[model samples]
Target: MLKEKVYAADGDVHPDQQRIYGRGTELMDAEELVSLHVHDGKCILDLYLRKSKEISVLVIGMHGTRHKVAVDIFSTIKQLKKHLYWENNFCLEGKVLMFNGIHLDDSATFSNYNIDDKSVLYALEIPENHMNIKIRISTRDITSVFLSKSETIKNLKLMIRQHTFIPVDQQELTLHDTVLEDNKTLFEYFQDQEDGQILTLSLIHHIRISLTVCINMFKSSDYVVQSVSLLGSDTIEMLTQIVYQRVFILPKQQQLKKNGQILEHSKTLSKSNLTNGDIIFVDILPLCKITINLGEGHKPITVEILPNDTISEVKDHIQKESGILMNNRCLLHEGAVLEDHKSVDDYDIKDGSILFLSQRPPELVTLTFQRTSGEVSELKFNPRDPVSVQSTIQNIIKGENESASKSHVYECKQF
Candidate 1:
């Protein structure tokens, strides 16, 4: 019989102890520290007392230096980290240990990963904590989170789970067309990112996932890509509403295209063949043109407004185009005033409707009244009509405790 001497890091257990080398033995957990080799009520082998061979490992430190160290193959990575820290006076925390791109678990043994004399391990140093990541939803709601640099991508998903209802396993993060692995660190992913910090408050945080989409809008008769963040579950109709907030185009007046195919409004962004950071082309749908006469004698301005837009919103657009303060402007349709809070649909405003852009209670107009006794008096009022100015003045006199009928006769004339 060939028997071997064993020295174990687990007090006498190793990953190799779980190997089913004999048909008579059942597999056991590495942490069980017991290898009952009895089969058919008879013992076959005592492998738990076996010792693994020593292996030389080359460690690539953060500064790019290489150090070869010999250690037992059954030693846990935690023990190796402790030895590295004591020998080189290295950092004891915020370090990510990796072997062949695999994140090494502190509780896992080197032999479990099949490490040999020629194996190389990377020890990367990172910030200890206070790394903030902001996750955003398609609705533009954001959630802000601060995580430890020592944390793994798996930890990141767990952090995301705390803020959103999405499960950790269901969450997928991506960057620049590559899916981020669970074992990777944020420092590895966002090392070059320049996302500056805000006031530690995000509207709601939804982390960067491969599910974001970009918008390409038509501007100046050509397409310009806008870095608009969107979620996969957002429907094309919802996308239109999101786009409308920026472009002022109604959903009905907007058509989206992906891969040169027109995207349906009822379909989700993902169903439209849109992927993370994919450019969704937008074209303004045909809209009804309304004639807005800037002033009494000014040339008519052609404007397209959505039916759902309020008069206040229309005033905002006019302010942008004509450089007029919305509060100082008012719209007149068919000789009736358009209230700011009302919508175009409320007014039944349609295509080719003539809207008069005018000022409210315009600058004072002067009027002179000639009394029968050869006396002249001046009356000033902001009027809707010159013809109503006389009646308005008469009402003002009545309010002042004077009867306009009993007052001396006078003929009014505009100055």
Candidate 2:
């Protein structure tokens, strides 16, 4: 009797060892033998038998999953040859059962085997198509009017033309490896039959160009432009340019003061240079307070502090106190979820700091009512019946009719 259990390398009485112990029985008589062993922390079975004089078969199966594999076998006289072939070809270093009749190859001295299981039998379940990328383009600020309908490549060229002094002749665009001619326009490149119709515009330049056009052009138009960001290199450059140009402005001279003295004068003084004579007379400006309207039905709360705290930290603190989580829940800061990694610290959060938090809109409910007039009958309603105010009014009207005038009604509610 063979016991079934998961086997490990720590050295235990397992089915694999049992198969090795029963090798003598296989040698005495060529017959199929089924033996189970736990290999590589999985339950597997080995089958050994002589299939033909030229080949012996060794089959292995994993528990639960129906994975069966076959290998070569060798005679006792050619054990050294078998050992050499097994070592160099099969690479079976573990306690695996080697079949006797399975040859390395048909009529060859070697055997071919794979360690695949039943899991490989299943076909991969993949989505047929991915969601199309939705991009919001602002054409209002663009001086280049053609961009409203321009695909990715045209937009990049337009952006490049707007920012850099680089001449169109000096610019070289490449799709994959083939370098596009300097004179070849982006639209022409896509129009050419040689160039693949599917052109990936680089997104790197997208934000930079968008931002540049946005800053330069005064008007704003909402455009659903296809961003070329999916196009690898060009998009990368655009992104890098945008990020590099994002400037962090420090407080202006008028806003920075310390201990009755302007910070500009203390720039040359060390911390230990404190003296009564160093105190300079200065004019004090009244604190400027501006109330931020938090929309139609929201109350604004103020926090008095230096503008050093990040928006994320403030949101976290607000969440901790109000039992409302940010991000997962809604916390409307300036009409949108804080852009990407942008923090509240970017904006000044002084004494009269105002922020808004909004809950998601409730789901809309739909109700439908169907009425039929008939003979005298008793009206009944389900406990879970969802009747609208209008339906209730109609029901009251129907109930007031005579006994001979009866009607049945059906209503449906959807959320």
Candidate 3:
């Protein structure tokens, strides 16, 4: 059976203390317990809905406790507080009620709640329509505005424009690839999903002009160029995606720009001011593509590394795929050892440059063990451990034998 270690942190302290939690361990003043079950020889964590039962709910107002009610799956909020006369008892009437963290509507039932297996129910006080959906415009300007999901896209645009000063006409709201219509409600788009889902907004500006542009790839004086028909109304972001698709680049790795200015997805192509037949440079990152030459006979492996990643991370990734240890390998860029602390940009490495990967001399050790049939097995240790020939069983099990002087060598093999 597979065993796994689980860790949890205590949030009550200034510096949060992390602790490994075992199966069936109680958590946070015994409020919850960690449970586990084995599936296909792997331990799976079980923390939800072991059993279900009716739970007591405490409903509160802005002032104080309004009602203490018992609720079950079939019970509705309307049934619990129907007895209170809101016109006379204005204290209880105006005060909005909440269950757990969600604001409760009159139609909201206990079935809507995500209940615990312990039959515990929670209700609290919050302002009316407190549940709000956050809308994010773009990663560059990540200022998020929250409003009720019941609000229409038109109202959402107005709210966002009020804060950003971006004209409502330029705003384009989208969920995945589908565009949100101004008349449609936000809840109508995400009601099928969970409540309070995040909606991404894309801003598009319309302009009128037709231009044919040529995209060229120049590497070591060799060129591969393609011509694309573009409109002034097309967004720079959209053009970036189209160019990347045509160039056979994965969407995530596509970084295209002209001049020194990185293209913003929300801006129109015309705003960047490119007339007909203007040349837009594709390679924005200095060290976008690199070739790692692994000595003689082995074909050179080429990879694309992100600009943000350090030299050490790239080396580690190479080690995983090539079965070469990071400590045993040294990366030489133009005959100089690359430092782990510096980024790829610091070395002035460019696309298609060859980086040499030189390996250190390996250390070998001799291991000897005896089988149940009274036959001795001995061999020089190799890094690639295979079953039957593996060193794990001999190192872990056979190493426990007190006769190390007769069966084991003092030399350690570098893995």
Candidate 4:
């Protein structure tokens, strides 16, 4: 670590001055002094013969990269950092240099640890064997790519395919104008350069598609012709949506038809014999699903109902399956009583809605009948029954008229 040279004597000193026993520096070892260069036909010693100062040590970087550097054995660890930082503009600013698994202090000299020429000092934060690189996909995707020096470009492509959803065959990655080869690694590509400048490559992708068909669709006067394009394998269900978006018509109100024949939604465009530029008419018939909860503890049922089905028809379905009487069934949704005359759509009931079913026992209705002689009679009947009170009174009056006629016949014979 000594910057100043040791003087044998001041001016033209005697050889006896160099051999000043027990009066000068301690003692010099024979192997300590290393021949640096031959200058002016004279030998020059770079390291003085003393302690570990004459030994050179190896420096290792992070990521398993190694650099065999010759450094002053007695030099402080901070001084060794200067040589590394200046070498090819490399940085060791935040790296913790460790010697024999112990962190080397900047203030501590190499001699403090009794280091030798075979000793290795490591910059624990520097990358060496393998590195983590960033990849910028053209789809505005940023992904992390991990690789060792031995990993091939094919492995990298596989990893990219897994993360970015881009097929390896479709991907043609390029760094500047250089197209990467699947057989070679990045280390082989940039082996000459100072450890492959922190890899950040831009990935390019190309997508391929086959045939597409354009169709003409009409919904009443709101017509949209040749505005939608689709593949031949597409279903009529997809066309319904395209018609709705183009013509501002609801999909539920749409029924695709060609030449007066209805097109089933499950059938594909090719299966329906539809070709490019074919015109299809849209019919208005919307259907939806409704859930009927048959009271508590009963499994709910789903019925596919059309716009024409009223609340009474819905009850009929429940009655057929649940055996609950039509009159006893009381259907309600969101606290509003369902009317027999009103359709489910009229109640603003959307598709896949739940309706509660509870029982309402029938009540009796009383009918009073008064005769011309001031005689009164009360007749009771269930209003929900098949026969009405008015019908019962009419039957009773017909019997009375017949009896009066018979009484008139008896009076003609005796009175």
TM-score of each: 0.37, 0.19, 0.28, 0.23
lDDT of 2 by residue, 97-212 (tens): 32221111111122112212221211111112211111111211111111212245444454445333233433334555465544445455454432211223321111111111
Best by lDDT: 1
Distance (Å) between predicted and true CA of 1, model 4? 99
lDDT string for model 3 (174-258, tens) is 7676878999987687666443333446644232333333343543444345566555556777776776777764433445465
* Winning candidate number (TM-score): 1
Clashes of 4: 8
lDDT by residue (tens digit), candidate 4, 156-181: 87876654566676565677758788
Q: Is 2 or 3 the stronger prediction by TM-score?
A: 3
lDDT, candidate 4, residue 24? 32
lDDT of each candidate versus the true structure: 0.62, 0.33, 0.54, 0.60
lDDT per residue for candidate 1 within 246-329, as digits (tens), equals: 667677777677678888899865567665545667776445578888976567777778776789988887777777676777
